[model samples]
Target chain A: MERGTQPVIKARVHVGLKAGVLDPQGKAVEHSLHALGFAGVHGVRTAKSFDLVLDETDPGKARTTVEAMCQQLLANTVIETYRIDIEG
Target chain B: MERGTQPVIKARVHVGLKAGVLDPQGKAVEHSLHALGFAGVHGVRTAKSFDLVLDETDPGKARTTVEAMCQQLLANTVIETYRIDIEG
Candidate 1:
């Protein structure tokens, strides 16, 4: 569909390090937060998000497309997890 | 609110390498995809996503809170960008 022809739907996807995976970057951030006086912070895991604008369509189909995108290109299932959100 | 008392809102966040950013992992993936016969794929940038379950409330407020979370903890503004999605 053309970009402006249809209602714009926004999809947000989040991928993060799975539990039991080592994240040196997250560990460094946690250390920094602790040094910055942020207490009560036990663990810090890092994640990512993607905001996509697509033509309005079937939510189920769109979700399936996105899930495929995640599996094929967006996420590393070996170390990360993903979720999707669609809004008009 | 208690976990079961409130409607579960799912938030997905995607973070990725910005343009001009170096991504060795992404480069490796691109190479692999090319070897696997996926042509027409020029540049590959890797990204991350997060799936969050939250208590239902005002969406605007929830978004603000999530934005803060992204800025403060979820994403690295230095090299990554993040987007949030909330669904009930």
Candidate 2:
């Protein structure tokens, strides 16, 4: 399908930091959860997810396309990894 | 289990803007993707995911606790919704 065309594909991309990386934000959340009396909370790490509607129809191509988008704009490969899920 | 205890609960919380809310960042990413020649992409929305390890063991309690966390810290209820997934 062409841009703005029918049969759009919906995609979700998840990006997360690599293991062993210092996550100050996640640490802060864990601290805050503990401070708020949710003492059972620990090891909290934050990540990102993206929802994209694509004009493409084929799932394979859509996944490939989103992979490039993640590398180019959505994720930092140096310290992060991304997974893409596509749906019709 | 007590805080910092063993056999921790792993919980994932997903937070996303409400359907009608504006997503300038998603739009910007969409625009940039098109500029990068991925013309078939559209309707991009960005969301957040949090991987949390809880000291609690019971799945039910973990979900309840994470729900409270989402309400108190993880999500802005006015403009966003959160979903919690719990695992051992």
Candidate 3:
């Protein structure tokens, strides 16, 4: 970590439930919205996005690193799918 | 809801902790990742995204509806900020 070096790489990981997986939280949201009179709303699902700032400089490496992170920690692959977007 | 009518509108609402807000969950996640050998990672923040499927056809109205959802239940406005993305 040197002074005046390349800016930190940013990785956005979007983690979401897989199709057909039951999501009680999402169901609650749909119900709440309907009770609030937003009857047009349906199929509400909850997901998570993580912003990771990493010291990696190469975009390819950064994406690979973050994808590993998602697989290891950020996402539950059995019931979730994740997409990684990287920018320097 | 007519058969084979206009496609459902999709809205993505990203809810995040405001700057200067204390995020224990984010800190814990960062620590966990570092413990697992991702030492290069830093400034890790966690955010929630909501995917809403609506019967509404107009993108503008769809955005408005989801924004209202964020203000009312999707986010804690005092400590959170949200961005809405709408698509059909």
If scored against the real structure, what TM-score would every candidate get?
A: 0.51, 0.91, 0.90
Which structure is stronger by lDDT: 1 or 3? Answer: 3
Question: Tens digit of lDDT per residue, candidate 2, span A1-88?
Answer: 3443467788999999999988899999889888988886778899998999887778999898899988898999999988888876
Fnat per candidate:
0.15, 0.95, 0.92
Off by over 4 Å in 2: A1-5, B1-5
The Cα local distance difference test for each model comes to: 0.64, 0.87, 0.87
i-RMSD of all predictions: 7.2, 0.9, 0.8
What TM-score is obtained by chain A of candidate 3?
A: 0.89
- Could you tell me how far off, in angstroms, the CA of residue A86 lies in candidate 2 after the best superposition? 1.3
Model 2 C-alpha lDDT per residue in residues B1-88, reported as the tens digit of each score: 3453467778899999999899999999889999999887788899998998777768988898899999999999999998888875
Model 2, residue pairs in steric clash? none
Model 1: per-residue Cα lDDT over A1-88, one tens digit each: 3354654445677777888998777677657656655442334556765555544466776676567667887789999888888664
**Whole-model lDDT, candidate 2?**
0.87
How much DockQ does model 3 earn? 0.87
Query: What is candidate 2's CA lDDT for residue B7?
Result: 70
Rank candidates, TM-score, best first: 2, 3, 1
In terms of lDDT, the poorest run of 10 residues in model 2 chain B is B1-10
How high is the lDDT of residue B9 in model 2? 77
